[model samples]
Target chain A: MSAPRPVYDPSWDRANPNEVRRSIRERGYTGYTAGLAPGFVQANICILPKDWAEDFLLFCQRNPKPCPLLTRSDVGDPSLPALSDNIDIRTDVPRYQIFRNGEFTEEVTDIRSHWRDDLVTFAFGCSFSFEEALQDDGIPLRFLANNNVAGVYVSTMPTEAAGPFEAPLIVTMRSFTPQNAIRAIQITSRFPNVHGAPVHIGDPAQIGVDLAKRYQNVGDPTVGEGEIPVFWACGLTPQFAVMKAKPPFCITHAPSSMLVTDLRNSSLAVM
Target chain B: MSAPRPVYDPSWDRANPNEVRRSIRERGYTGYTAGLAPGFVQANICILPKDWAEDFLLFCQRNPKPCPLLTRSDVGDPSLPALSDNIDIRTDVPRYQIFRNGEFTEEVTDIRSHWRDDLVTFAFGCSFSFEEALQDDGIPLRFLANNNVAGVYVSTMPTEAAGPFEAPLIVTMRSFTPQNAIRAIQITSRFPNVHGAPVHIGDPAQIGVDLAKRYQNVGDPTVGEGEIPVFWACGLTPQFAVMKAKPPFCITHAPSSMLVTDLRNSSLAVM
Candidate 1:
């Protein structure tokens, strides 16, 4: 059998988010969506059983920067007409990670066979929108230059709980010169729905992340001298909480793989 | 004599700028206005013969940050009805520095005897307003704690010439931690009338001031390690240019002595 094409290849970069979602639903494309959907908002996907949905919704309400909700589907509805007319929450994302009894199981290209009538879907604002805003402001982003998002991982800080939904906060770190960091703050501040201005601006230890060990288990933590590390509440923050509040059934887009929406990122700017 | 009261003390702190000006005009108080009228805007006063006024005005236009004009009196007029109701520029400021043929003469408490019908008055914004803004933003100002304004000096950069009025730029430097310096930039950026933002940030030598010697020829320079020395256009900049032009006569506020206005510092915020 022939091996499948890689997601980072040029062809995928040019593909629109809706088109990518269509292919995932039809062709079983299980790959990352980091550089996809150029100027559109990409979401952190979460599908929960009705039993756990209300609490997670409340958890997002209490901590908006990490989980700004773009749209949420009605229980067992499988569709979000507001985000995209044709979006199917059940199988539109490129890949899904199944969590059974609060633990990770095998990743799958399609989740149709596992769908339940009580599953409710939530789409959240992600950093890609504001990352686009930063570049347009003439501020250089080192990680994006190498085609990467800022580092991400769980922090020891716990999140506000709603009933059964509770977990530690997860964050993403971006490093920039003092001047550029300020510009980044102003630019990102305009996009509050996408994790507005940095939560912390200086030393990493204050936020409980080892600069030398960043998402250390998941990503790079080495920051250069004179460069300040800015931490933003991350989309993965909700996932970490979800993992802690593991219900009988939960699903998420595979890490770095998201559901691209038809909405443009500029539409997210508060100003 | 009660050993002659010191030139400046916070005891003068609560005094209103207009009250101070009225007292100085009457020769009742003849000292510096530093730290008086805490939240009010202070102005650097300049008086020039009508012949030289046009060029000096143009010079101010060319270098606005250094010579931001708050108000200008018509030729031969000392009353600035626009800036304040009971204002008489000739006798308002606590002290005045007399310049004859571009050379410093005696400092006087009142200029009424020296004032002439052919002279015009120029009021420029000083750093006191923006400094107040930084403090309000929760950015600690170290120099204020040490009872000093930012350092003063002349730079090699030449000012645009209008008539005979022309000279190199003069600036003020204040050191701040890189992070605080960035906060200072954003806060000050709102007030263009008060030397908005900074001309240059980081290494001082790049702008031609030898950090080691500074401009002690005019005033002392204070900078600390791990602190970026941010420079702003100084109100004295126009004074330097005006002196070089050397009409028959000119006058300016004495160093550290300023004319207080009824206008609050908050009145200058553009945002």
Candidate 2:
């Protein structure tokens, strides 16, 4: 059996984000990036042909909470100058998932060979920014201790469609005591660029979310007794929409692997 | 026998705050100030003898959410220049409740006859400002239609004490659909001076509150089916603490009657 994945290392908390990106580009750090570069913003990356990029941009504008657009690269340009100067999207991301007609085709560390002249890159904000804010405020996140990500689910709520992009809004669920949940709502509300506040709290059934059946069973979904489940609009929402839209060719960062950026998490706070 | 309390009038939405206060000062309006001067901030008033005022101020400082101090009157001075150029605490409030040795003794239309040189007036932020925000955002408040105020409850949470000023935290509970509740939390968070966001949500028993048993059975305490109850730190908390401290003399605005101010509710938004 493959060696068990490594637990978060405390030293990663102090690592420079650019150094971490270099490691990711060099294939020296292929693991998921949870604890590394604690203060910087990490993004959900999606690359699609220019023809499909227009509709995706409208989709993000229509549903900001689910797809908070951080920056969009120019057509056929690999660098997102707004996020970083030295970055090259194709080689900087730790892993890339290739999709063919809405079906996952393969996973690779670098997409240099698959890069296209007609491609456009979109970087959407991720939850790690607000999660760091929550932790900084002393709100405990139990899932982090177990090396598990938040529970992901497809909610009954429908997204405002844009062209061919239409799908159920996907959400990430985290549980907290009623007190901390209120605090989490306040803390997250400050970062409107990063999912900004929860979409639902309390009864999961109200949103048609079954706590026992997380989407793809990607993480620990168990909510302890006395803890209330809070749900935030997830970054996976755009990918789910991509699956439904069935663009001829598409690429996304692998789950749990994200595009590290030079933007400070605090800089994202609108307040 | 009370000539059926008047329902909210639409014209009050356009009434000038200072003009409305003038009517209150002249006894033309002796009714509750709920809908009058719609966009203005109305304050909860508390007057205490100089000896007890110091400790009461300390109590408010220690428990800001429940008793957000808007302005404090100079000892023996009736004017609050910070709130308005012409505000006279003794005459501006529509009604006042007099307490002797912590027991409410009488309610009167005016407190000018009882003014003293050693008396100090304290004005606090009220939930009405935030309520107006919630309504403006299209969050329907069912209790307002029935002319019922939020349920008042004595929670298990205790307040930090100063001198003899100590009591259980008094909370005002309102019920909303989960969706509106999230919006309410966000809207209220913008007005920190007005009790801020909710202290607790969901299961009431977790905070030792029984839905059927409200403090003194004031207002309607019902939680409708499928609606979630959100509890906010109430301005009544300081009054409760005053009752517990048993100071020789105290004065507060009668329930539902408040001091009108020239400050617009929008000015209170921190963000």
TM-score of each: 0.74, 0.94
What is candidate 2's CAPRI-style docking category based on DockQ?
Answer: medium
lDDT of 2 by residue, A1-271 (tens): 1222435544443268888888777634666776777799999999999999999999999999999999999998999999999899999887789999999998888999999999999999999999899999999888888877899999998899999998898999999999899999999989999999899998999899998888988766878888889999998898899998999899998877788899999999987
For candidate 1, the docking band is incorrect
TM-score of the second chain, each candidate in turn, equals: 0.91, 0.94
The residue ranges of model 1 lying beyond 4 angstroms of the native Cα positions read: A1-37, A50-62, A68-86, A152-178, A200-211, A216-233, A245-248, B1-39, B47-86, B100-103, B116-121, B134-186, B198-249
Clashes of each: 1, 0
> Where is model 1 chain B poorest over a 10-residue stretch in terms of lDDT?
B1-10
Candidate 2 chain B, which ten residues in sequence have the lowest lDDT sum?
B1-10
All models, DockQ values? 0.16, 0.78
The root-mean-square deviation over C-alpha atoms between each candidate and the true structure, in angstroms, is 5.5, 2.8
Interface RMSD of 1: 5.1
